[model samples]
Target: MKITEGYMPYLNYQTYYRIVGDITKPALVLLHGGPGSTHNYFELLDSLASDDYCIVMYDQLGCGNSYVEGHPELWTPETWVNELIALRKHLNLTKVHLLGQSWGGMLALDYILHYSPTGIESLILSSTLSSASLWASEQHRMIRFMSEVDQRAIEIAERTGNYESEDYIIANTHFMHAHCAGVYEIGKAPDCLTRPKKTGKEAYLYGWGPNEYTPTGSLAGFEVTD
Candidate 1:
């Protein structure tokens, strides 16, 4: 399969994207989680790129291979929605299917609500929370499930508001690996995490928190249920 790459100029910066498989086929756009996450996490999506669909993946502004020079305010869902619209127009895609995971699903919802683009054929939301409150509730549950020692560490970190501490991060990663994907060993890991250029870290720091159930970043108060 041939892969083509390019940049789509947006208001604040350019979004980098790649197209795989046949462009003549129906388009399937993959939206990664992390309001700041790159398309790298969705490399497993390549499996769907064969003859049935044209796979489109891109690093949203401020992430991955995309331009990172911009104001933090530009990270809002409104800006990302515009980026998606620009990319769709640049590709000249008449209609396309969308698959979004976690924060990516929120972006998709924003796009559908604001633009209501005729080009949107379908939407797939995976492992996503409908609102920030729901996410916070889930985090509490996850923290409760942790071992007593780990739970105490998290409680201390939260009390001190030291979310960036190594202890917090370590506990958070363990929780994610156990509950998020249910994979114990690294060797048996999923393809997305095994990709050479994974965007999990950058996205987590900027958009999500150190854990799947926690929201410690700018998106902490973000709610999509409305």
Candidate 2:
């Protein structure tokens, strides 16, 4: 059970990465969600090292340990794809397995389709989307089933594009609890979910918009269903 962590150069910045388990073992590279989320959320996955795979996790360009500020241009999927390619080459991951969750899943899809690089052994997509528009629609549909107060709060926020309102935050919290972390009781999520440090808020807003159910950013038109 060996663990190592460090930074790798990406573009003009540094990307922080952590490795758990035997380095000689085949790499099980993880892709975390959030065009802005951190790899810290994958902390529990380190136990897989005992199962004989070297677990690799990293903070993408603008999130967590690898955070950078004021570069909204880097929030696009293309930048992340390129960063992943660089990471693979840097780590000499000749044989790799990918487990992508949510936005991370989308990044994996983009990496494979956009680059079609070799040496990828397997892909696991979890709770992800191939169509941003479809995801948004589904979220809205889910919202329709909530209490009228929740529904109206969300509706008013969406209509006014004012997500900062207290009512909207309350509504959004309800939606998150029901859909995002329904498995855990309120304020009782694991450290992964409750860890300190801000997720790349600027990037999240620029790449995926202000909330989970909306899409008014660069990824608003993103789709790979075809």
Candidate 3:
């Protein structure tokens, strides 16, 4: 097994990436979630390397080691989509599998729909939704089941724009653990679990809003309406 790490230029920026396992074998590109998240959380997929597949993981520009400025304007899905294309080409991967989690999964779908890209052996889209409004709707359904106190707190926070309040964070964490797919026991969260909290906030807050339920951001109105 060989591990190679480097940066590839993309649209005036450098996208950082890592390749695990044998480059000659079938490859899997891993994309992390968040318009501003990193690839570190996907490290658990290193286990797939032992099975004879190349595992490629990268931090999109403005996140992790990509080193570009984390401007909200650069957080568009198209930018990340193009970055993935540049990464695949720079790595010289002709035929490969792709697995993207959450926002990464969304990127994967966008790439596929845009090009119906050939040489992609398969794709694994994990914990992602095809529609943003639908996501908000689903969020409503999910939150409806929480305790009445939490429900009222979330509503107050959203209405007051007080998302940082202790009541809001506590209620948000409760909702997140049940829905965010990566949270854990408070004292036992590994770096992967805590990383997105450290990455691009403007991107997350501006793109997806304060939380899953309140998508008052750029992506708030997005959906596959077509």
Question: Each model's C-alpha lDDT?
Answer: 0.75, 0.89, 0.79
Backbone clash pairs in model 2 (N, Cα, C under 3 Å; residues 3+ apart or in different chains), count? 0
**Pairwise lDDT winner, candidates 1 and 2:** 2
Deviating ranges (above 4 Å) for candidate 3:
50-52, 67-70, 181-198
Task: Put down candidate 1 lDDT per residue, 117-166, tens digits, no spaces.
Answer: 88788999997767877878877886787898778778887788687777
Residue 4 of model 3 has an lDDT of 85
| Clashes found in each candidate (C-alpha, N, C closer than 3 A) | 0, 0, 0
lDDT of 1 at 163: 72
- Name every residue pair that clashes in candidate 1: none
- Alpha carbon lDDT of residue 222, candidate 2? 87
Query: Please, what are the lDDT tens digits per residue for candidate 3 over residues 109-176?
Result: 88988767779999998988778888888898999999998998899997899888888788888998
C-alpha positional error of residue 214 in candidate 2 after TM-score superposition, expressed in Å: 0.5
In angstroms, the error of model 3 at 108 is: 0.8
For each candidate in turn, the TM-score is 0.83, 0.93, 0.86
Candidates sorted on lDDT, descending: 2, 3, 1
lDDT of 2 by residue, 1-226 (tens): 8899989999999999999987667899999888888998788888888646799999998889989889888888888989999998888888899999999999999899889899899999999999999999999999998989999999999899888889889999999999987655657787777658658998899989999999988899989997
